[model samples]
Target: MERFSNITEALMNEAKIEIESFDIKDGEKIIAYFSEIPSISGFPYKIILVENSDGIVYARFRQWDTEYDFTRWDNGVYNLDRLRIITDEKILSQTESALLKEYLSQLEKIHLPENINKENVIILDSSLWKFGFILKNKNIDYTWKAATEDINVFVPLINLMREKYLDRI
Candidate 1:
């Protein structure tokens, strides 16, 4: 079982990127959850809506695989290996792309905590918003908890992605 003491710390160490943290009250909260149930297949896939306490919202998506590894970026767009392409005639639809862009736009708006208690690991990429915590009625007390840190938030992220991918099939 892998443990991420904090999201920022795990991402910084695993992805080797630097991030600054602020007060959770000033950070973004999960507003809505979306999963496509018949498009893509296998692995973990998901999309999430996050909004700051000030009422600003955005979305981001993540996909994980156990095979093949590569990273490439053109202009501001990032294409990582073959995971970007689902099938010959079944690629990411315009709606999904637009939705992801909307989420990416808020990447710099939310505040991630400096430290959080975690107990598992999810293979993540260079994406900034890798993990999202689900809340109930905007209440932190209702957040989901997994036995291990990895099983907690990361597993749900993968499940969402899987649902979305299946939707395209």
Candidate 2:
């Protein structure tokens, strides 16, 4: 693994480890919290991803402490419409697993956007929450969180995951 000086490299390594151990087991979940330039109300948005047995996955997107929202997508083969409508449990058909696997593979290729500078910046405010990821299963849970005023790496990954969850991958 690369050293911690590069935040994006470190996060990609950590995410790969968690993804390897995930196994897509029933009830396994990976939740992430990201703080973009804080909203006018001063809260960060949250993203939750739930993966169930047989490669089933569900995603929820919500503004900080508010109701859920979803983007519209052209109905595709192996639809997740029910999950989209109810924002709950649903399964992707076998044919969809290939696409899902491709998405997962993209995670391995995550690179810090060329436009983002690697130089670090310190945040004087102690109250700001850093971007973080939490991995949990029936037996154990682990998390890695970082607080930073700079958006060195997270913005791209967050955007990628958001697109994937919205079926725009």
Q: What are the TM-scores, per candidate, against the unseen true structure?
A: 0.26, 0.34
Q: Please provide, for model 1 over 11-48, each residue's C-alpha lDDT reduced to its tens digit, 9 standing for 90 to 100.
A: 22332211111123457655444332211123333455
lDDT of 2 by residue, 42-68 (tens): 323334455554345554443322112
Worst 10 residues of 1 by lDDT: 14-23
Please give the clash total of every predicted structure, in order. Answer: 28, 1
